[model samples]
Target: MDPSGLPDFHGLPDSPVPSGAHDSPSLSALDRRIAGCRACPRLVDWREEVARTKRAAFADWTYWGRPVPGFGPPDARLLIIGLAPAAHGGNRTGRMFTGDRSGDVLYEALYDVGLASQPTSTHSGDGLELHGVRITSPVHCAPPANKPTPAERDTCRPWLIQELRLLRPTVRAALVLGAFGWQAALPAFAEAGWTVPRPRPAFAHGTRVTLPATDGGDDLHLFGCFHVSQRNTFTGKLTPAMLREVLRTAAEAAGAPTRK
Candidate 1:
């Protein structure tokens, strides 16, 4: 149990595996490992606390309280990057952006743009799937206060790097959901020798950047938008129409035939 009086996923040694283990695995194999991760003790403790408290209204819901993994078609060209897992949202549901207020606006916009098969994200078992998109987070684990330190973000980069390597699907564009996701991808881009321009690029509702590939090929495009956190959505920092337009632009750049 944790300070919040909730059960921690780390308590069980045989639960899920942490990222970067020598599993000789595919995306699904990585998914299983991430489902039982206990690497970050701090995150594990905080997530358990959120689960235990139940928050009154969510008392009956089963808490996932574990690491969250990216989910979508293996060949997806559009990669959607989110900030981090939410306490009651991704941490409780064991799936990114599910079972929380953040997902409400995200899924709705996804459906409106014809990227999602459904308009709601209830739980991991809700059979949600993205037709041409894949969703991942900067930090796979739920951070205390939903803010991951720079070190924590660095620690989590290997997993994202591996995922991108394995899912090399001629990426159309990336939808960075917040400042953290944008910052997290920077190191990866630098490692790949992609030249990013100055002014560092700011995080806004619809900012875009193009990076040259290492192979001297076409540049990869990145789009920035506010995270789908409850605070942003409820406060009107992002709107459904704005999100839909971003998706449309990404989809157009991603090319139509790649959807298959």
Candidate 2:
């Protein structure tokens, strides 16, 4: 295990040279490369800095610090994309959508819909499992103020594209959480061989776009949802029922069964 005592799969503590994620032949390889990525200087600095100076609540915990990787099965049918990791969330737990309020809402919804084995994802080893869903983000590293610059988003696009390519055979639908993820994902889907529309549909809660595969493979149903951030959830902008409705619809679109 690394100095943090978490699994060694999260990659080295210090950022290495740029990881050529495009060359990854499998999802596992892509995840390792993503975790070791140091492509963006600003993100690299911010994530490491946050790791060193942890929040008061988690002062006794060892932070993951390095880039967080996607979590779930390689053959996931439903892919959920979000913005970058939360500095004290994924950046601390070493797994996407874990250890944060956003994750609390997301995992609970997934569990309610029978997509997840548990309703809570407190850490990497919490035994939570996604049935046929995979969670990832455009930016692997946490950024300052929970926002990654456009350039950083562009720089991280290749990893998402490669991941899409690897999951192309199985991923039939995607749930993009927020405008940032929606914008970032559209281009990556096109690059990964899915035929996105020319004008690119505008982002809106409950928006659905069907992207036909260039190779005549299965079509992808993309759904947009408000982010599960505290701002939305606390303010009732994204209620539990609303999130579950979107998740259930998207999961069904992917041909994955829902409990209700």
Top of the candidates by TM-score: 2
Where is the poorest 10-residue window by lDDT in model 2? 1-10
Steric overlap count per candidate = 1, 0
lDDT of 1 at 81: 88
TM-score of each: 0.84, 0.95
RMSD of 1: 4.9
Off by over 4 Å in 2: 1-5, 10-21
**On residues 25-92, what C-alpha lDDT tens digit does candidate 2 reach at each position?**
78887777778778788888888999999998888889988888899999999999999999999999
Tens-digit lDDT track of model 1 for 1-260: 22222223353343433445453257776666566666666777887888778577677776777678887877777888898888878877777887677888888888877888789988766667787788888688888887888877877776777676555546657788888798898776555445677767777778888876776755768788888777777787877777778877876676522222
